[model samples]
Target: MIIGVPKEIKDNEARVGVTPAGVRALTEAGHKVLVETHAGELSGFTDDDYQNAGAEIVGDRGYVWGKSETVVKVKEPIEPEYAYFREGLVLFTYLHLAPIPDLTNKLLEAKVTGIAYETVRDRQGTLPLLTPMSEVAGRMSVQVGAAYLEKEHGGRGILLGGVPGVPPAHVTIIGGGIVGTNAAKIALGFGAKVTLVDLNLNRLRELDDLYQGRLYTLASNSYNLANATREADLVIGAVLIPGATAPKLVTRTMVSQMKKGSVIVDVAIDQGGCVETAKPTSHSNPSYVVDGVVHYCVTNMPGAVPHTSTLALTNSTFPYLMRIANLGAREALKKDPGLAEGLNTYQGKVTYRGVAESQQREWTPAADLIS
Candidate 1:
């Protein structure tokens, strides 16, 4: 099997699909790996590093995409890369197709076998591939929100951890999943008063035990969300519904009622955001004002820390990549039920039920294809 690793071309995206270590692992397993020139440069890995790991360096993006049987990437393929898709090519990446109708259409039209990392599940029904990056994004959400809270950034001039005489800022996280948990951890580390809201009572109780009453955990009803937003100095929208679009927990009206210049870091922006007013921004211009509140909704927050993000992401994805490379997609997916859940689109059909329902498209079970 020939695997390709292309440099991520999304707005301000610096992470690569694989690291030198990953390439070496693939090569040792008798798979040929092709890496785009300088693909890992942003992640602090050089072309020489990939070469030493037994990967051939391709000069252009087209070569890697065209020649490889499976193309692994950090982000979804942008418009320019759409032309490279072929009938049998496998695209393994974070395809948040629920929100991107155009990309979804392209994958179907081109008959590409699309495997989304974000939808891939583990034996315990947890998102293994998405967890590492989500952890990074969740932690960074607080760090970025804190910076944007300064007066110069048009935020409510307040310190996350206040001085001796002042009260700490109120930080509200709208989910208690991996992203929200990491955000709460960082916020509490800063001595900020934190509140985490979620729909699962058992998970909430678990968090209660984990945090030991350091933060408030509330039910995820509309009234609770709105009230929490109003009291929040910084709101972290960390809600997620797997491969589906994130539910709008914080409405525009609720946002308007929040303190002026308050910051919202929507970690769920990749899944179309849980805040009604949230729109994806780039790291270069990460925040915008919406109804007197600041929104920091960068879709690729982990890209801001490419070195850590790339390594962490590859660590989880490499094992699955090797499985597909060694056994082939059909045999590998059929053998592993969890990996089959990752199949969003295969052979011109939507295989993931959540994505099919979200996109309003015809659906087919992955077993239909593999069988």
Candidate 2:
């Protein structure tokens, strides 16, 4: 099988799909890897590194896409790359298609086999491919929020961990999953008063015991959410619904009620955000004021740290990529039920139920199509 690794073209996106080590692994398995020139440059991997790993360095993006059976990418294909899609071409990447109908339509129209990392489940029903990046984004949410909280950044001028005789900032994290959990970890590390709201009481209980009651865990409700946000100096919107759009738990009214100059880092912005006012931004323009509150909803938060992001992401995705390359998509999906869950589009049809329901479109089960 011939695989293509193209340089990411998203706004301020610097991560590459495959690293030199990943290329070497594929080459050792007798698979050919075509890496576009400078694909891994931003991630601190030189073109020579990929070449030394037995990968062919191609300067033309079209040639890279034109020659490969499977195209491995870090992010979903942007509008310009949409022209490269063709029948039977396999696209393995993070396709948050619930919010991007245009991309979904293009995949179906082109009959592309679209496998989304975010929807891929492991044996334990956990999103293995999405976990690494989620962990990165979750931890960075606090770091970014803290920077934006300074007075010069239009924040409330409050320090995350206040000095002696000054109370620490209040942080409200809306979710208890990987993203929220990691955010809470970082927030608590800063010595801030952290409150986490979630719908799962069991998970909340687990968190409560895990933090020894230092981290406040609240049962998710409109009232609790409102109260938490009202007192929060920084709000982290970490809600997720797998491949579906995140529920808007924090309403515009809630944002209006928050403290003036407070910051909101909506880590769920990739899934259309849990905060009503949240919209996808880029690292170039990461934040905006909404009702006196700041919203930092960069769609590719992990991209800012491409080195760590690429290493962490590729670690999880490489195994699955090898499976598709060696066994082919049909045979691979048939063998691993967990991998089949990653199939968002195949044979010009929506294969993931979450994306289909979110788009109000009909979907055929991957089993039916693959069988």
Candidate 3:
């Protein structure tokens, strides 16, 4: 199989889909890898590194896309790259299609096989592919929020960990999943008062015990969420629902109620955000003020730290990529039900139920279509 690793064209997306080590693995398995020139430069890998790994360096992005049977990418195809879409070209990437109907339409119209990393599940029903990046984003949320809290950055001029005789900032995380858990860990490490709200009481209980009661875990409810946001100095929206849009737990009224100059980092922005005021921004323009509350909703938060992001993401994704390259996408999906869950679109049909329901489109099960 011929695989393509195109340089990411998404705004400020420096992470490459495949690393030099990944290319070496594929080449050793007798699969050809076509890497666009300097595709891995931002991620700390050089063209010589890829060449040493037996990858062919191609300067033309179109040639890489045109020649490969499967295209592995970090982000979804942007508008410009949409022109390259064709029948039977397998696109394996983080396709956040719930919020981007245009991309979904293009994939279906072009009959592209769209496999989303976020939707892929493991044997334990966990999102394996999405976990590493989620970890990076989760940890970075607090770090970014802390930076945005400084007075110059349009924040409340409060330090995350206050000095002696000064009060520490209050951080409210809106979910208890991977992102929220990691956020809470960092917030607590900063000596801040952290409150986590979630729908799962059992998970909250687990967190409570995990933190030895230092962290406040609240059952998710409108009243609880409203109170938490109003008191928060740094609000991190960490909610997720697999391939679907995140529920807007924090309403516009909640934003209006927040203390002036408070910062909001919606890590769930990729899934349309859990905060009502949150919208996707880029690293170039990462934050904006809404009702005097700062919102940092960069869709590709992990991209800012390309080296770590690429290594972490590719660690989990390479195994699956190898399987797809060796066995072919259809056969790989057929053999592993977990991988089948990753199939958002295949043969012009919406194969993922969550994306279909989010878009109000009819979907055929992947099993049915692939069978």
RMSD of each: 0.8, 0.6, 0.5
Error of 3 at 371 (Å): 1.2
List candidate 1 stretches off by more than 4 Å: none
lDDT of each: 0.94, 0.95, 0.96
lDDT (Cα, 0-100) at 232 in candidate 1: 97
What C-alpha root-mean-square deviation, in Å, does candidate 1 show against the real structure? Answer: 0.8
- Give candidate 1's TM-score: 0.99
Candidate 3's TM-score reads 0.99
State in Å the error of residue 85, model 3: 0.5
User: lDDT by residue for model 1 over 1-371, one digit each (tens)?
Assistant: 99999988889899999999998989999999999998999999999999999999999889999999999999989999999999999999999998998999999999999999998999999999999998999999999999989999999899999989999999999999999999999999999999999999999999999989998999989999889999999999998899998988899999999999899999999989999999989988988998899999999999999999999999999999999999998888999998999999988899988888887888899988887
- Each model's TM-score? 0.99, 0.99, 0.99
Per-residue lDDT for 101 in model 1? 88
Candidate 2: tens digits of C-alpha lDDT, residues 167-280: 999999999999999999999999999999999999999999999999999999999999999999999999999999889999999999999999999999999999999999
